[model samples]
Target: MKVRKPRLKAVDFFCGGGGMSYGMLEAGINVLAGIDYEPNCKQTYEHNITGAQFIKADVFELQEQELEDKLNLTKNDDNLILIGCSPCQFWSIINTDKTKSTKSANLLIEFTRFVKHFNPGYVVVENVPGVLRQKKESGLEDFIIWLKENDYKVHFEVHNVAEYGVPQSRKRFTLIANRVTDESIDLIKSVERKVTVRDVLGQVNGFPEIKDGHKDKTDFLHTVASISEVNKKRLKKVAKDGGDRLGFANDTELQLACFEGKDNSFKDTFGRLWWDKPSPTITTKFFSISNGRFVHPDEDRALSLREGATLQSFPKEYKFYGTSTSAIARLIGNAVPPQYAKCIGEAIINNHLNAV
Candidate 1:
């Protein structure tokens, strides 16, 4: 008789829109639940991730015993995996006003509290590269020390998601720890080739050209933001196929005042993407031309919500719910690219579960 393989299960904290859980599920792991504080995420998470329970609460307020009881987790469960990708806005390089993020800066440390209580077999953390450089007050260094002292074998590094088949040039800091064995696990590996914008969006059809702020009549999420008449004309004059705003014919008069008189600071703004290259990192304001190189390579308008979700490796069928365009964009942009998360999940299965 054939023997059944032991089951691997996961619970994701800060599980925005279920991206990480979706990827783990795709990797054949049973994702039991997702926890987050955002009320808007509840519908999106439950709708997309079929079986996983969505718990809407702040991670800091929930006790470890409550979580363990909720998940039916026991100490040192060999198949248990805990994922925590705490809110990174405070630690990201792009966040200019660090002073306002004082509350968010401590969320990573808050995650460590659960780690101590549950003592799961495996733990995974994803965050911005700037997290490594945060001051001692943030508790990142201490977290690492604690993991080591607990007899967990830990490995961490900065990885480019494009290298793992995500169609974006996003770099993130990732750490994987396992207390079951002394052997270190490596999550980063080179793919055969990079996934590109053309590869993912080339054959997508039925995306009607719409101005900014107009939702597609046929598909609500396929809508683009409304563009001003002046910007519309500027987009038409853009060279196309990766052309940038700097290449505009009359920058001083047409461009924003910030770009007057050889002011090329935000050169990527109002720029078109290259078809063959991976897209720039997807952000909440990806639909606006004023934000980064968001213009389509061939089309005259910036990317729609559907296009942004596709670039983030969300399947066509994955549903998103939000109050407005910016809200939906926030859900999509803040998610872990499902493809990259799948790679990390697969590593854990192969390195630890299979080894057992």
Candidate 2:
């Protein structure tokens, strides 16, 4: 008789739109429960990740026993994985020019509470590159020491999303902490080739020529820019097929806030993307011309929601909530690229299966 492999179980915290869960599920691990504060996320999460329990609650307010009971978890299980990607805006270097808020950083301490109580077999966290620089009342030195004290074989590194087959030049901080310490605990493995915009956006069977702010039959659309008449003329002058503002700039309005009086400073802002290369980071307001290289390569408007999702490595069939441009953009922008999450999940499962 053939023996069946035991399934690894996971619970996702702050599971916005179920991107991480999608990857884990694809890797054949069972994602049993997802917790988040937003109620709207529950609808989108359930719609995408079938057969998973959704709990809408502030994680800090819930006790460990209450959480375990809610998920029907028992102390005997050593296969439980606790994943948390707390909000990164507060710790983000982009916000460094302004006052740094400590409110979101407190969520890490809350995550620690569950880690202590449940003593999960494994833990995973994904955040911006700036998370490594965050300090609190206990300080950064104490923070590292505290995790070590918990006896976790924590592996962490900063990696680009493009390196892991996502068609975006996005960098993130990833950490995998496991209680079992062997050769299997290593997280840094071979890097895949960079995924390009052409690779992801090529050949969808039905939908084509997505316009900005135009929702499909599914009612999902990307945010559209509110370009002024003057800027509109300039954008037209910048040429199509990976054209940028430098092509049209003569003298006036040539100085960008960041560039001012520099030369050889090339980055795509108010620019069209090359169909071949990987896209720039998809920010919260990716539809704006000033945000990044968000302009459509061929169209006058920015990318549609489906285009953004495709670039973010989400499968074409994945559904999103809210017809409003900002609402849908927020859902997509906040999600982990499913492809990268799948890679991590696959590595975790492979290690566990080999161990047993």
Candidate 3:
């Protein structure tokens, strides 16, 4: 008679819109529940991910016992897994207005508290690379030390998601810990091939060309942000493949004031992507061409909400709940790309299986 493999159950903390949860599910892990502070994520998380409960609450206020009771988790569950990807705004290099002194600087520490209390068999954390730089303020270094002291074998590194089959060049900090085995585990691996914009979006149909500020009547999320008449003309003059605002650098009237006198620092803004290349990191304001290299390669507009989500490795069928485009963008941009998360989940599962 064949023996059944032990089930691996997981709980996701700071689980924004179920990205990590969805990935873990894809990896054959039974994700029990997701906890997040944002209420807007409730519908999106519960709608797409089956058999998982979405608890809307701040992680700092959540008690370990409450989580244990909520998920019916016991201390003896040998295959229990904990996943936490804390909010990283305060630790992001792009967040210039805020410093490490902000209130959110210590969210990782709060996440560590749960790790200490539950002492799960496995723990996984994903954050921005800036988190490592904020060693003094964010307590990331101390957290790693504590994990080792508590008898958990931990490994962490910065990864470029493009290598993991995501069609975006996003860099992230990832950590994986296990109390089960001493065998070495690696999260980074070479994929079959790097995914490009054409590889993913080339054959997608029904995406009609939309003007600025117009929502597709058939697909609501296929809407584009409003562009000014001047910017519209500027976009028109740009070449289809990998064109940028620098094309008009010689035109004093059309050039931005910052670039008037040999200032070419921000060339990535108002730029179009190359079809054969992976996209630049999809930011929250990806719908605006002025934000980054978000312009459509062949279209005269910035990326639509659906395009942004696709670049972030979200499935086409996944739905997002928000009153406005910006709100939805926040959810998509902040999410750990589901494809990358699946790679990490696979690593964890492989490590566990090898150990057992």
Q: Rate the local accuracy (lDDT) of all candidates.
A: 0.85, 0.74, 0.85
Which ranges in model 1 have alpha carbons more than 4 Å from their true place?
A: 1-3, 188-190, 203-213, 217-220
Write candidate 2's Cα lDDT for 1-356 as tens digits.
55655688999988988989998898888999888987878888998897898888897698899988888887635588889887677767663533454666677777777877877777888888777756453133354466678776677778887877788888888878776545335444335567777766634433376444454555444335456766666677767778886765564664455655544565577788777888988876676777667887767667777778878888977888874667777778888889889888887886676554
- Name the lDDT value of residue 137 in candidate 1: 62
**Global lDDT for candidate 1?**
0.85
Q: Clashes per prediction?
A: 5, 1, 0
Candidate 1 lDDT over 140-227, as tens digits, reads 8898899999999899888999999898999998999988776877876647789898887744544556556767644337877888
Using all chains and alpha carbons, the TM-scores for the candidates as numbered come to 0.94, 0.87, 0.94
Worst 10 residues of 1 by lDDT: 202-211
List the RMSD of every prediction in angstroms. Answer: 2.0, 3.1, 1.9
TM-score of 3: 0.94
Which candidate do you rate higher for lDDT, 1 or 2? Answer: 1
Error of model 3, residue 268, in angstroms: 0.9
